[model samples]
Target: MTAMPEWMSPPRAEGWYAEDLDHLPEAPRHTELIDGALVFMTSPQRWWHGEVVTALTIALRQQAPEGWLVGREMTIRLDKRNRPEPDLLVTTTAYDPDRTWFAPEDVQLVVEVVSPESAHRDTTVKLRKYADAGIPHYWCIEDQAGAPVVHVYELDVPTGAYAPAGIFREVMKRPVPFEIELDLSTLTP
Candidate 1:
């Protein structure tokens, strides 16, 4: 009998570390590996979240410095056993075009447009993970309110917590260097 390569091994029902993801024959829709566990996402309840994401992307493009990438729906490898697809990500242009996904090291900012089902996970689980991985920025957009609200978190290296940047008013863009000048109302549903 021949031994199979690690990637070819059968996947465990839960607790999916990064190594296990390498063997996934193909990308499974709406699944992210968190702390070695497979977390599935429900489809968006409405298109408002997506529209906000698009607005943010466009705003970033207009204001971000050269050599920075404002990307949407990119899979970032946060650790050996975890990957989460954020709605938006900003990073320096050093990304590897040949690689199938961006590793944690390649990430600079991660943004999540919260769905009704995703609010808890986004604020707690995902927030902690991003902080642990030392990701510089994390943004959570909540549209449940009549007007969309965005929560910005910046990593504090020594303490490792994602502290809020501030309460942004009508227009909330990504901070300078990343280009954050947009009318917040446009992003609201």
Candidate 2:
């Protein structure tokens, strides 16, 4: 077997830290830290995933209030050892050119466009993690016959868990995280 690349080695005995992602210039793009380990998104992105993410980013940006910001494929530093990159995020923080990852508290919503390779993590692991981190909103978008179906959830502050708000297809409208409506059909070509 070929030897592992030097950059692939963990910088600490406990595995990778969230902040370490910034210093590793040679690490692959979209690298994430989960439970103190590096997780790389190596699978080729499906065209549907890319299109939906781009379209959603645009749609969200258009409706975002002055203080809100919409971003795509940005990592959220949930904790010292967990920084998962959601497909899309809506934040209250102002634009910062040098910002690499967002703090969970600053993010109002996170959208994950589910791909086959990420279905389990997106539906289960991340679902739990994002809620535990106190993010107010989470939307997991799944492809149903080439159309995007959004599963929206809101945090139950008392329990520190997510409560299903709605599952939207064709169109999605939400009041919290700012009022916005989206025609899901337009997200895919």
Candidate 3:
């Protein structure tokens, strides 16, 4: 057996657990656990990013039914090792307001707003995680010329993956999960 080089060493402890995230000051804030691996986030990446996330979170919260919650940039524990902090997510069940993370089963929808540093992860990495966890809805919002463009997906039960539902630019009206009508222009502006 050969020893691994220092440059090739893992970022954190091997087979990281969700509870370990609680101890990292930057975690569940600027870090995430993906399949037992630690992934750092780009904080304050863009001013528009936070604004859009706030808009979507508010929209989802208003439409959420009783016992449901809309979380922003909070961790969702998909398993013992996979705790991903999505930009926005809707939980099917209400939280105690002090919980650190959510179970995958309670997450109905997950949203990600792409940034230059996280474009690949937001589109491919997190997309696969949410699909594997069987989240009913996923929305990928991209900023184009200071406007928000949304790409919607619905889980395909037979394949345990997501299928394209629709793409919205100026406005979005959806009935699944809950009734929501969001003005997309307001998100970036």
Candidate 4:
């Protein structure tokens, strides 16, 4: 028998899996599966979001150490039921060149640019997951009145959590993964 259409069918009550996502159409995207639930993303990201994501990706890529890969809107497999697509993330040398999703150990840092609907998850939910996975670093980027504000955190290994490292509104220069100099103002298109 032919398999039923996923995109057209009603939501699954059984929940979603990382593998199940692979069969869906690429266009008319929906939310990333989190803990097997179809959790929706915030309202569509405005143009500024793209500009900021692009700018941050470029700045991070230029300084990323050898063997590190910077990706945008890429999914990281935290577990069988949880797959989060961070806005931007830097993967370590462990990143498999042939793979689409990354393992926790393969990720050195995960950055999320907050949207009105995603602030809670980016700040609390994802923060906890990344910390528990021992991803090491997390950056929460928010655009306030057109200027990006960055909140940096470093993992407190003993606690399996992240400790606030810094809150940068303008010049974000820090030593995490590497020394990064990101100018928030430039991200606005």
Best lDDT among the predictions, by candidate number: 2
CA-only RMSD, every prediction? 5.1, 0.8, 4.3, 3.8
Clash statistics: count for each candidate: 9, 0, 0, 0
What is candidate 4's lDDT per residue for 89-171, written digit by digit as tens?
88765655566677789888999988888888999999998898899999998878888899999999899989999999878
Model 3 off-target regions past 4 Å?
Answer: 1-13, 26-28
Q: Give candidate 1 regions above 4 Å deviation.
A: 1-14, 22-27, 173-179
Q: Arrange candidates by TM-score, highest first: which order?
A: 2, 3, 4, 1
Show pairs that collide, candidate 3. Answer: none
- Relative to the unseen true structure, what is the Cα RMSD of model 4? 3.8
Off by over 4 Å in 2: none
Better model by lDDT, 3 or 4?
3
lDDT of 2 by residue, 83-185 (tens): 9999999998989998999999999999999999889989999999999999999999999989999999999999999999999999888999899899899
Per-residue alpha-carbon lDDT of candidate 3 for residues 48-138, written as tens digits (9 for 90 to 100): 9989998788877777788888888888888778888889888877568788888888888899998888888889988888999888999
Name the TM-score of candidate 3.
0.87
Backbone clashes (count) for model 4: 0
Worst 10 contiguous positions by lDDT, candidate 4: 22-31
Write down the lDDT of every candidate, Cα atoms only.
0.74, 0.93, 0.83, 0.82
lDDT against true structure, model 4 = 0.82
Candidate 2 vs 4: which has more lDDT? 2
Q: Local error of candidate 3 at 22, Å?
A: 1.6
Candidate 1 local lDDT, 1-189, one digit each (tens) = 988566534366555666555567654565677777766665644678778888888877777787888888766788777787788888885756655567666778888988877878888988998888888888887874556677888888889888888656676756543646768887755
Candidate 1 residue pairs in clash (backbone atoms < 3 Å): 15-36, 16-36, 17-81, 18-80, 18-81, 170-184, 171-184, 173-180, 174-180
